[model samples]
Target: MKRRRHQKTRGDMMKKTLLAATFAVWIFNVHAQGSMTIYGSIDSGVTHISNVAGTKLTRVDSGNRQPDRIGIRGSEDLGGGVKTVFQLENGYVTDTGAQLNPAKLFNRGAYVGIGNNFGTLTFGRQNNFMFDMVGKYSNGFLLGSFYAFHPGNIDDLTNAGAYDNAVKLVSAPISGVTLGAMYALGEQSGDSARNRAFSLGANYAAGPFKIAAALSDSNNRSLTLGQTTGIRTLLGRTLISGSAQAPVYSALATDKVRSVAVSGSYAMGPALLHALHVQTDISVAAATATMKSSELGVNYRITPANSLNLGVAHTSLNDMSWDQLTLNNVYSLSKRTAVYAQALHQRASGTGTVAAVNSFGYATGQRQSAIRIGVHHLF
Candidate 1:
């Protein structure tokens, strides 16, 4: 935990140091120059998990249907089809009114850049293409809640996937196709590539169908794994107290890590179909770990105000395997508010592995389940 905290702290500090100049324009008030907007969402709930090292527990949860966050973003017209753009977003804990990440005030994103009709180029702390492309086309989107994310979120579909000190380019849709690329600097003094990362993605949308694909590679601990993926999963970590924790899914720290994924969604009348596949590989020093995950799901809008989601996923990490099932129901109170209930179950097999569902932590048994009831609001 301490090591992970320090890693985020270093990333936040470096991003701030590297992008201070770019953000000056934003500080001077871009709103007066053009258009600005404030936006936010809050999702809080009560959840029950069947196992946490053998004891069942119920508690309050935040960011279930959506992340709890508030942000300000704006663009200043530079004329001739060009513009200056910037955004600052932060996440908070609904239960305690605390920042999601204590390392920085804008843990979600802090970036400034230029945009044209064709595309946009941005710099600073941001998310990778993997999160952008895969998320838009994956079953995870229809599920509309973190509870339905695959076990361990090994594929990163449900992870924050944030990168600091990053430069990113995203193209506007052209003939239904959008392209994206990103790179994050490690900024290490002696060695240049110690913690560098890069990612590429493409997305296509046409009427009722959409598809996306992404590729990513990183060195050391450059990329922030999803909250569920953890930092090191292979042998686990040694705590500051000198105690050891058993490995959860198998994300061993390595010199190099690579990931590839593709996902698609189709809308048919009031029903939606979703499918996705993800592959992750680690090599060079330490031990090699490979993880593969896939999912298929469907979402149906039974009524304008009611919807249902069902999904099943499978994951294989080296010698460990996990299978999960989830069901969710939601009722829209209005365009910006909704109430939901979800249930998830996971079955684990292989090499001392125990089942663990999304955001419920670890389990001591081979079977684990969770149920949650929540409300989501946006403004």
Candidate 2:
């Protein structure tokens, strides 16, 4: 009887151990299945302007130094090293709690795709190759809002809006390199010639050096309203005479724009060097013109909690040009909280025009300069 009882007890112990082991395996599998995360940033600051076209000098408190934004991203594991992924992101004014655009909810990025060791295929509103490749390398990526360079002078590529109704495919990283391309549907039922764009890009990284190149082209129909007065007359005449391809006063019932950019970065210990060169061409009705810009920057890590950044860029329109210099310091209070101050000085040279109010605030035919300082935060 004693032997039989001992045998039963040992058997029960073995069963319990096996049960616990099985439960542990189940838990591990569940944990490895997938995850979803919520992330975003809230940045706002006060800006003092010395001169704003059609407005008096003033100081205004504004939101979106870095552009307040929120995003939801997730991924689900599938068998065979494949996964399903999606992201919905939007921009808003944190101070006012208002959407940047009431018309659209996910104004920043809204895409769904399948990703795996083979790469990712995504659809919906997403960033273009130029923005992903060249824009990311600019000093503006670090300056938040106080810097005039926040969005690079290629306003036509960055500001016209994120690509909508688009489909994109990215190749798996191989030998430390990846390639991507995208196309927009134009959304026209029959005539697909109204407004359409397409882009392609490739990036390679090896050791401490990385390089990226991209090209994008867009076509749109434009109508310009002519005003026969003052500068408007001069600009209108220039547009009509084909001397300049100004967007105003000229009816570009059809317009085409192309951009090319190359960016690279090199890292050495706590110091890094970055640079980019971008060129854009616009063809509208009987007008064709080109704009070129370049940026060079350096970043130094002073400590675990602080860093210093300096950048310079030169923008030119057919020999006429302007240069901008920026200096910034960032101090981190925590992983999700930080404070920064950036100062920018822009000067115009040659016969280049600056401060036009179209998109990048770069106007043609005027020489102008300004400075800005502000802060940014993320969570």
Candidate 3:
């Protein structure tokens, strides 16, 4: 009788343990509930710019601190130290009511990923490591957006930067250090190297200082002739003799483009200092050339709601040189709204130099100047 009783007790104990385990799993799932959010920003400005085709131009422009955008982002907990994340953002011009890129929606960002404590792995359209690091650490971009980018945006440190069909990975910060990498497919059949691109980078942040370094490499992949690609837009009018008549890809023939850059910032009391340097090398079937860009700037917080920014930047492409100075001020009306004013002066000097103010396009002379007053709101 005692033996049978012992056997029954053991069975009962096993059943209790199984029930407890099932209850624990249910609790974990309940606690891992997912969440979603919708957010966006709108920025507009009145801009007066000069030295374009021997005429002074003035107009209403969109996006100063940031491009006008509407986005949906969310995360879903998948239990056991894993989650699903997604973001879809679109850019637009507030004044004209047109999409920033007429060819596609979500021109800014569209990505989905799985993430946990280890890191995040995402897929879809994204930006290169060089653009991500420089935008965060360079004063020209951090303070003034397009007004602060290097000439022609040769280093791709502005709103014009993006990569299609990409995979990106960013490691969780460990001990004030973080690392990220990205690879973009050129999508041309039968030629894997035609438009493939890749980037690697690392960043460190400690106390009031932050620094980042990145490297990128890309190739021309389009098979179609004469369709303007990223490479053509970046090197416009700077091509070697007789190359302009040829399609950019044919003239360069799968040109290999590489770039390396470093940027950093330091904070002291109410003032912050920022600096960056970028170097680019382009190699093609016939010739190779190098471009170098540098910038130094400072931002001072005059009060809780007001700030001032000043910066000087220079870029050299082959034999041409461009130098610029900018002053900007911003005042906050609320936590999500602000107003700003900025002034810019640039000079291009050399035998064939022309002053170009990035998004403003090429100027008629060696000197160019611009002024902008704008407002920004976030929701």
- Which prediction has the highest TM-score against the true structure? 1
Residue by residue across 155-241, what tens digits does model 2's lDDT show? 333433378888889898799888999998888879796578888989899999988898887778342312211023221234333
What's each prediction's clash count?
0, 3, 2
Of 1 and 2, the candidate ahead on lDDT is 1
Per-residue lDDT of 1-379 in model 3, one digit per residue for the tens?
9999999999999999999999887666644566666798898999999866568999898877887889888888888999999989889889999998999699988999999999999999887888777568775666865767876565666545578899999999999889999999888899887778998989999999999999888886222112211123233432333353342343444377788999999999999999999998766565666878889999999999999989888888677788989899999999999999999998988775678776675676788899999999999
Model 2 Cα shift for residue 81 (angstroms): 1.6
Of candidates 3 and 2, the better by lDDT = 3
Superior by TM-score: candidate 1 or candidate 2: 1
Best by lDDT: 1
Off by over 4 Å in 3: 1-33, 221-254
Residue range 36-93, candidate 1, lDDT tens digits:
8889999998999998766999999998888899999988898999999999999999
Over all chains combined, what TM-score does candidate 1 have? 0.85
Better of 1 and 3 by TM-score: 1
Worst 10-residue lDDT window, candidate 1: 235-244
